[model samples]
Target: MRYARFTGLISVLVANAIPGTALGQSVRIVPDLTTNSIVVFQGVDETAHFYYVPLEMDFVRAADGKPRLGVQYFKEGDGDSWRVAVSTSIKPAASDSELAALKAKLPKDNNVTLSPLVLDFASSYVRFSEAKKPTIFSLESGTLSAGSSIAMKFEFTGTHDAVLQALAASGPEVGVMAIITPDASLVQGEELVFSGAAVADLFEKEKFLLLNSFDESNAVVAFIINGNHSAEAAARSWLKSKLGSPEIGKDDKGVWRYGWDLTRPELLADLRSSPKISLPTFSNVEPPNKALLLPFGNICKDYPDNIVNLETGTAGCN
Candidate 1:
């Protein structure tokens, strides 16, 4: 009746399309935004290679005045992991009683709950093969989170702001959204190397040591660009100046990475036109040249002897 368990390899492409398709009448709506939810991807082929990871968090309005991006679910804890800081200068957006009065000034945690996320595309799922549509899909009214649940009936031809305005007219140069909070005074053998706009000007000059009163829900922000490949293509034309064409990937230890999701508007006006310390300051920024730790997962395996290069992802500074 309800199944939200979906694990890897698109679940063997939905169990090999369940013995010759006949369930998915054609489910579409692919604007993954890394996993802000809205990916009923089983086919009707817009380009299928389908695989996903963003687990629900769609709010929109990431440009034009900046700050209106939702669905950043990052729950994991003990040493650390939490999420919730969607106040990027609030205005017309930010309801739900203004994000519950800004999550009541943060730092209380009854085991975390930021609230404001709402995606229930009838329990979303997406594991497509060929043949037809064996089963396992459901999406009728978005606003459901707690991802991976199996349900059926996905044929959303358009909407979700028209597939994010057709993926912002197929262009992506988005850069620097770094907001990586967590530093329990970080000294378990310290390591926070720098390169290319030095961690976005060290989050705009030590953003109060990456704050998190009790729940920023394991704060996360992307636009990660590690080096080699012309210093990750010169840190993507020095933080998105060229725009679009950035699919580079390889983080589970194999260095060399690249990421996006600023939602392109001249790449968010070239990352809000200056202020990542007015860019350029890489005196060989280190670790394959100007690194910012992106050797992949476990946030670079929780710093296993930093100076990155988990099999060539490069970084060093003993």
Candidate 2:
């Protein structure tokens, strides 16, 4: 894994303390809902350094089902160039006090705050530029047989400049976003629906998309589909169609999953098989689980995980 090489680089960046010119640096943490990973951008003026820290174990979940971390540091990478490194032996703090103590070691003046922005793949749409007034192609509608070459746009927030920068710098490539389907919605035979209205509702409530940058607001994102497989199977099939057949197998919990083995160049060529626009990062998230931890490192000891509110620290669970 490319991220395996940056283990020491992360320690030097996080533990050695921010440089004396710390005022010029900006640290923003955003939850990538698609991958269930925390994406941190250490922005310095126009250029930014990126880090992707996965919540592998002992993490909390927000009301909206987003994963929250308690001072975690594990993976580091350059989003612009697509080089990643992760620590293998690192783990989350065992207790709240220990987590706090670990946090205290950070640079005193450092402003490490979470960003309201997030990247979601639950419902995705692509806008075609061939028409006078761009038409939308919804991935949920099924396979797009619009020939081999097609042009389209994927909408995203302007606040995601760092992510956009990374994608733009990487040039043409297939960008994959993990699809997180709720257990309740997992009907075996029924097809799942992801509509633009749902995305609009989410944006209206959270203001997740802030169209500040004209250049970064929208990018060419491809969501190709074919055949009549179930939603989950369709997702896997889409990847397989683009990146070739994946390693089909079961996980430790016996749940089936698809794994792909290809170099960066090969993956990019396969994704760009058709003359289409491409994004940089690509991955998926697993299904939801019970016994989720709180953002403050408190475990919920009851059912209906959504009832426990992080703001008031109330709702019965202790």
Candidate 3:
């Protein structure tokens, strides 16, 4: 029973991380509500560099129902693989002594050390928000630079795999962030390329539109439906009428899922008009457990078993 309760919390928290609302094109500044404080973007040219700074505390409830402050960064233009995120926990520190203690506990190996601006950025950025924008800033390389925030540059000593392993082992005692960079030699040649935000945009629509997998060749788009059996049945039947037969399943938390094949032209036609699922506003949504990480690091997995979250000592599987 305790296991079941933990799993239920995991499901809700995981769902909460999903961006509650769509972002507008005009520099949608959001607090990085997770651990990653400074996001560093490496450019195609060795000299090109840019960053996004979150200027305030974006607090969200973890699975344990405790509030965690986080920040997020965004960059426009084509995608680049040399993106690194650095984050730490400072809000929980009640005093200067406590903050120093926490900083002392940070990892120094693998070139992972606390930034001098870590505390200042944490304390000062928390003061700025969507309502109260930062007065001083500049746009560089398609990213918003909060000029006042401390600049951070991290150097990892090993390969991407080794760095990732080191990061996973850092634990909650020290805040750790992940960098998405390729290990291959070709990475140097990797230039920014356009990725359709169609999927991301569709997520905002909350409609029964096609949710393609990372490999866009797949024919099915799977979506989560929040409702009881009757509601699920109604949705399923309605979908069947429009798009024909679909694979239906329920998650461990009893959320309904509908998977439709896009290979069929007729289904594709109907899918464009499939009804949108009305979701609760973002303000009402709760954040997922920070301890519990997303399965395969993908936020939009289908089954709960694919989702994993870390408990105190043991790892909880979806």
What lDDT score belongs to each candidate, Candidate 1 first? 0.27, 0.27, 0.26
For residues 182-265, could you state the per-residue lDDT of candidate 2 as single tens digits? Answer: 212111122223332332333234321122211222121111111222233344444345445445555558966554433345
Tell me the tens digit of each residue's lDDT in model 1 across 199-306.
Answer: 444344322211121112212222233221222333435444434444555544795555443343454454446433222212221111111111111211222333
Q: Could you tally the backbone clashes for each prediction? A: 29, 7, 10
In model 2, the worst 10-residue window by lDDT is: 1-10
Using TM-score, rank the candidates from best to worst. Answer: 2, 1, 3
Question: lDDT at 64 for candidate 2?
Answer: 67
* lDDT (Cα, tens digit) per residue for candidate 3, span 146-165: 22222222222333333233
| Residue 229 alpha-carbon offset, candidate 1, angstroms | 3.2
Candidate 2 residue pairs that clash: 3-84, 3-85, 3-86, 60-293, 143-225, 176-282, 178-284
Model 1: number of clashes?
A: 29
Sorted on lDDT, highest at the top, how do the candidates line up? 2, 1, 3
